[model samples]
Target: MRHARNNELTDRRSAASDAKAALLTAYRAAKTAAEPSRSARQAERISLVEAREARRAERERLKHEEQTRIVTLAAQKQAAIEAAEGAEIEARNSAENARISRVVEDEAARKAERDRRYAARKSRQA
Candidate 1:
């Protein structure tokens, strides 16, 4: 049943194609006849010019759209990369701060020890 339906569709499509082809041939013959009617010639010229202009405009619109999409995507990717770099820099700064804090603590402990010894010796001498 499916195959029969497909065959029917194919036949219908061919019939339409043939009809279209015949009409096109007849139109061409009428246009080229040794003495074409003034209206027929003018209509053909106007249609051809309009079709060409429409196609040119469509191509320009498609090209502009494609360029805009490419630029927008590139900017988004660049922004993502910058954000990642900023995060890495912030992590490095935090690590350095922690390291410096440890060093400062050790220096303060040494100063306290030195002061305690100096006071003890001066009291014994007095």
Candidate 2:
């Protein structure tokens, strides 16, 4: 019985050592095989990140351009409005000047008529 128990213990130790050696060999193979896959995945992720950043930058540029276009349009509209308002003011001033000239001419005609009537009446009395 003692010899049999010693044999069983030896078998267990040998099996455990063999298992350890097989696990080490498999780990070495997996380590060598995994490098290319890991590098490829990392490179792919970096490229995707770069593409997204470029797209974001392009979108920002387009947005800025749109804003600039809108501002330019607004400025043009403002200039047109100012020009139209200035023309309207000039027209009103010209109409008022014409009306004042007509009023002055009418007053002169009335004064001349009154002087002529006075001179004729004085001559008749003499």
Candidate 3:
């Protein structure tokens, strides 16, 4: 009876030890198997982050360029308006000078005719 009991105890202990070793081996194998996939997932996440940053930078650049374009166009439009106003003012001044010149010429002719008539009348009276 003592011998049988001892044998049974030893068998149970051996079986328990084997089960523990098997569980450890399975855990190690699973960790090894998942290592490549885990690293791949991390690399993919890093690439995605980098791509997002690049897109944001591109958007910022585009926005800046658009603003610059808008400012340039506004400045050009203002310059055109100023040039047109200056031309209009010049035209008005030219017209006024021409009218003054015509008035002066007409006054000079009238004065000459009146002086001639006065000289003739004086001769006739003498």
TM-score, every prediction:
0.53, 0.67, 0.63
Which is the leading candidate under TM-score?
2
| lDDT of the structure predicted as candidate 2 | 0.96
What are the candidates' C-alpha RMSDs?
Answer: 15.7, 4.9, 7.5
In candidate 3, what are the lDDT values of residues 21-73, reduced to their tens digit?
A: 99999999999999999899999999999999999999999999999999999
What is the per-residue lDDT of model 2 for residues 96-124, given as tens digits with 9 covering 90 to 100?
A: 99999989988888888888889999999
Off by over 4 Å in 3: 1-35
TM-score for candidate 1: 0.53
Candidates ranked, most accurate by lDDT first? 3, 2, 1
C-alpha lDDT of all candidate models, in order: 0.92, 0.96, 0.97
The candidate that achieves the highest lDDT relative to the unseen native structure: 3
Better of 1 and 2 by TM-score: 2
Q: Which segments of model 2 are wrong by more than 4 Å?
A: 1-32, 120-126
* Cα-lDDT of candidate 3: 0.97
Q: Which pairs in model 3 have colliding backbones?
A: none
Error of 2 at 78 (Å): 0.8
* lDDT score of residue 117 within candidate 3: 94
Candidate with better lDDT, 2 vs 3: 3
lDDT of model number 1: 0.92
> What ranking emerges by TM-score with the best candidate at the front?
2, 3, 1
